[model samples]
Target: MTIRMQPDYRLSIAQIVPRTEAEGPGVRFALWFQGCPLRCPGCCNPEMLPFEGGTPMALGEIVRQMGQGLESHGIEGITLLGGEPLAHAPGAAALARAAREIGLSVMVFTGYTLEEARQMPDTAVAELLAHTDILVDGPYVREQPDSTRRWIGSTNQRVHFLSERYRADDPCWRQPNTLEIRLREGELAVNGFPARSAVGLWRRPPWRTPRDP
Candidate 1:
């Protein structure tokens, strides 16, 4: 019998939406990494910016969950959102590779431009970029809120279709942005772009507050 080895890499994640249509193309598994070095003003995920808090999960476990999502929800892809995915590039690369191995597409949202990402000193960042099919890059400028592009936060950010899996003129990208709300594991969680007037209307109960891993 062949001996099997478990994946040992772990990632610190602020949130995990197993299946979401608003995160990227089609229903996708969206992961928000816990820490970010860049302090972009008016960041959407302010809670996720600190390096201390998150759920530390093994690569194997995350892969298992991805498989479950694929089987249950038929997710077409995986999207890596942040607290800066490049800050956790090694784990992100590993996850991207795993997703690709299982025939899933990969999308990434990053504060760094394509040029900056290419110049990063870490090879893992490069690896993650290689696995990415679409990358939405540049910092979120609150002043330049993009009302036209679905899923993009600001007008300064650029969308790069690194691979041929998607197209700029795709009708999917032209659709209006939407918010997804779900009662997950007894906690009410919301994802996607929210209307400005409704931004602070709801808050998670105390049990769902951000905590250290």
Candidate 2:
């Protein structure tokens, strides 16, 4: 599939973690783009929803970083997360193309359903989907929060295996939620879908007993 580059070759990114085991099938370099039109209720990364925020980065630079991540961290793939990755189709497509050229599997998480995304008028969106190995799609519904599924937020979200790189029958994909925490530069970032119990624990103070003040 031919992938088209954005006219400016720039992507507005919320964040990029060089390595993370919680984003996909294996350890991966995760890229979270900035800007999202669909403000899905109970979105986990609301900070990334603003279109005007995030650093505008060159596609080349982002690809260069992914390459470095592969070499330095021995990552298995790249996971594209966002503020609706499909909203920035061109740049996201370009990034996916670059990652695949180097033999890295591409996994994308989006608020758009697979059928809805396929109907998009933009060819870039199709191209991006073509290169994607696994796509987790659907809006995050607060009423359907999922804890048993790996790498997905809500029960309504579906995981599409576009390529044979991963199998649906694999137990790893259906395992209970697991969270990966990273401490960098004194900032702690948590990745992955946390179980309800985990969320409660995270909210509770370590020093306090269940009934203590």
Candidate-wise lDDT, in order: 0.81, 0.78
Name the runs in model 1 displaced over 4 angstroms: 1-6, 195-213
**What lDDT does candidate 1 reach at residue 205?**
28
lDDT of 1 at 59: 86
> What shift in Å separates residue 81 of candidate 1 from its native position after superposition?
0.6
lDDT of 2 by residue, 1-213 (tens): 577665457888877767777778777888888889998866667777889988888888778878887888888899998888999998889988888999999999999999999999999999999889999998988888776777677889999999998999887776666676644444455666672113411221111121111
Give lDDT tens digits, candidate 1, residues 1-213. Answer: 111235867788877777778788899988888899887777867777898988788888888888988988899999998789999988898899889989999999999999999999888889889889999999988888888888888899999999888999998898888787766456666778862213521234222432311
Clashing pairs in model 1, backbone N/Cα/C closer than 3 A: none
Instruction: For model 1, state the Cα shift of residue 172 in Å.
Output: 0.6
What's the count of clashing pairs in each model shown? Answer: 0, 0
RMSD of each: 5.2, 7.4
True-structure lDDT of candidate 1:
0.81
